[model samples]
Target: MDKLKGKGKEAVGKLTGDRRKESEGKADQVKGRAKDAVDEAGDRAKGVKDSLRSDDDR
Candidate 1:
């Protein structure tokens, strides 16, 4: 996962005193979180759509 990789990179950056790597790692984590949010929203939408279809059939 991006978050996991980011954590590793952040840790290594801190140990090696590389600010760029640390920033990149932080950015990666944010991106991963955003992606997760979008996926969750899509799933929720699908659930709503399915429920509506079932209700219509009934």
Candidate 2:
């Protein structure tokens, strides 16, 4: 999602030779990656919790 958009912005910046845009694009990519990692962690945690609940019910 955002990662793809950031990549597009980065490519456009490089083609247009916009240093500011290029930097912003790179920042966006980093932010996107960080957010993705956080989301993955949250999902994993939820999965573990769900598993525990199911096991307790059984």
Candidate 3:
């Protein structure tokens, strides 16, 4: 998953002394953040769908 990969990159940055690795970690962190946002949006949409379905039942 994106989250796991992000953590791995961060760990590698700490383990190695490469500046590129550090930068890569930072980039991966950003990617992970975006992925989280997308997931939240998906959850919100699902909640709306469920609410609409319940209303239809009523």
Candidate 4:
């Protein structure tokens, strides 16, 4: 969501020649990607834990 929004902002900034907006847009993209990486890592950990539990049940 943020990534897509940031991309739009960046595109608009570029089209309108706004340096501040472009910088902000770039920052937002980075922040969004960082959040996604954290979420994916957490999900992977949960999956591993669930698999281990299932194995133990057998």
Reference-based TM-score of each model:
0.89, 0.81, 0.68, 0.87
Identify the leading candidate in terms of TM-score: 1
Please estimate how well model 4 matches the true structure, expressed as its whole-model Cα lDDT. 0.89
Error of 2 at 29 (Å): 0.9
Q: Per-residue alpha-carbon lDDT of model 2 for 1-58, expressed as tens digits?
A: 7777888889999999998888888888998999999999999998888888865585
Where does candidate 2 have its weakest 10-residue lDDT segment? Answer: 49-58
Give all candidates' CA lDDT scores: 0.90, 0.88, 0.80, 0.89
Off by over 4 Å in 2: 54-58
Candidate order, lDDT descending: 1, 4, 2, 3
TM-score of predicted structure 4: 0.87
Best of the two (3, 4) by lDDT? 4
Candidate 3 lDDT over residue span 1-58, tens digit each: 6667767777888888766777777788788899899999999998888888865576
For candidate 1, lDDT tens digit of each residue in 1-58?
8899889889988999999999889988998899999999999998888788865575
Cα displacement (angstroms), candidate 4, residue 48, comes to 0.9
lDDT of 4 by residue, 1-58 (tens): 8898889889989999998888888988998999999999999998888788865575
Distance (Å) between predicted and true CA of 1, model 4?
Answer: 0.6
| Residue pairs clashing, model 4 | none
Ranking by TM-score: 1, 4, 2, 3
Which has the better TM-score: candidate 3, or candidate 4? 4
